[model samples]
Target: MSHAPVLLAEAMTALALQPGALYVDATFGGGGYSRAMLAAGARVLAFDRDPDAIARGAVLSAEFPDRFQLIESRFSEMDRFVNEPLTGAVFDLGVSSFQFDEGARGFSFQADADLDMRMEKSGPSAAEAVNKLSEAALADLIWGYGEDDASRRIARVLVQERAHHAITRTGQLAELVERAVGGRKGARTHPATKTFQALRMLVNDELGELARGLSAAERALSPEGRLVVVSFHSLEDRLVKNFITERADARGRGSRYAPDLPPERAPSFRLEHKRATAPSDQETAGNPRARSASLRWAVRTDAPAWGELEAPALAPKAEAEWKKLI
Candidate 1:
């Protein structure tokens, strides 16, 4: 599956890019958004943690040497990379189709490949976490990240199975999960899907990165600049939604614990729209991965800059339990 930027038009429109305005594509998966920004006459500074993404960007960099910049780093470090305040920034969250389709990347369960689900292909592979983590820790990771209800039972089965034979392949882990979960019934998706998702999130610290990336984006944009984010999963969408809502409403009068922080004194971003925008039926039909995507955007206001917002704390007990499994 080649990477096609999801909601390209919607994201660009939300950004309201101005001619020659500096912009950032925080998740430059395939450089789809970066190319679009350049076409729209905006100067782009893009970041992608994946080396493949960076290498692929070479063509675009050469084509628009003066207008485009590609940085091989996570979006969490966006603030450190940009010297000037940005006119806008876009974040297309979740694993890319390119990553999933490439058999060697180990991002997909459909392909029987090595258990290496690293987004950047540098971090700990899924195989390491699955085979090394303790049962309790594995359960916590599956439940917390994947939202799998039967994580404990699945983890137990994994431990038992791996003890006899180390699980080093995607197919092996998927099979173990299916057997433990009693297999997917007719019309149901694969039973191992959630477990794979959970493991990927943990291995990459995705949620943590999103939290920090949002804050960095908010801090880095110039007043009136837009911050657009497109999320494919509820976990990612929920964080994006809450972050905007909280910041937009943070200044209002309330309890002592939440005293009225004036709007002018609040961070510069103002929620641009009320609800998230979803992909059209046409888009979903063309790209199944776009089916779950939800886009949200906000405009930076002239308010005073605020301190960095803290990333949400993961459930400690669940986190600790998952840590033990690893």
Candidate 2:
């Protein structure tokens, strides 16, 4: 199936694309954003951590050799490759349609596969996390990353099940979570959805990547350059919201969580839209996945870049344990 870029029109409008201007598609999942940017006559440099995404982009790169390039790396490292200040950059965050639909990739419970959720197909995988991490760490991961209230119960089940045999498959883990959660009757989504999401995010260091990528975008964009992001869940949306609001604040009072820090920095961005833009009902009807997506954007200012964003370490225990395994 062809991958549909969520909020395509909204994101394109946010970019305000200008012909010949260099723009970065920081998450070139299906090259949808890159293709659109190129169509608008922009010079596009796209980045993707997943090797599959890079392989899929070869045709687009070949078609526009002079105008388009696809880099197989994380968006957080974009600053290293982007020599010139950018005209615009867009991030379609979270799992791409291609990743979710391709059952063999192990991104979804729709089809059974290995418990591997590595975006770059490297480092430790979800299976290692499921079978090796302690019960307390698993609970922390699910509660912190997944935000599921039944995280402790789910974690206990994982520990118990894995003792008999390793949780090495997507189907196995999903079933375990479903049983742990008691099926959560009337739930629109699957019982294991959040569990799967948490594991995938951990395996990819997703929130950490986003925090770094936003900072990279801030450093790389020219004055008035657009930085657009589409995030799928509360955690991502909250981080994006805070990043923009904090930078756009003229007071520069630092974060409320860190009140002791000096408020000496100037505003680095202009937040034109205070609220995030969501897909229209019409769009959601066609693509159910668009239901949770939220789009937020900001225009870069002339002020000096701010300090590097620290990825929120929500579950220290889980993270510490997972680090040992990797």
Clashing pairs in 2: none
- Model 2's alpha-carbon lDDT is 0.93
238-276: candidate 2 lDDT, tens digit per residue: 999999998988344447776565555788999888889
TM-score of predicted structure 2: 0.95
lDDT of model number 1: 0.85
TM-score of 1: 0.92
Instruction: Find the candidate with the highest lDDT and give its number.
Output: 2
TM-score of each: 0.92, 0.95
Q: Which candidate number has the best TM-score?
A: 2
RMSD of each: 3.0, 2.9
Q: Whole-model Cα lDDT per candidate?
A: 0.85, 0.93
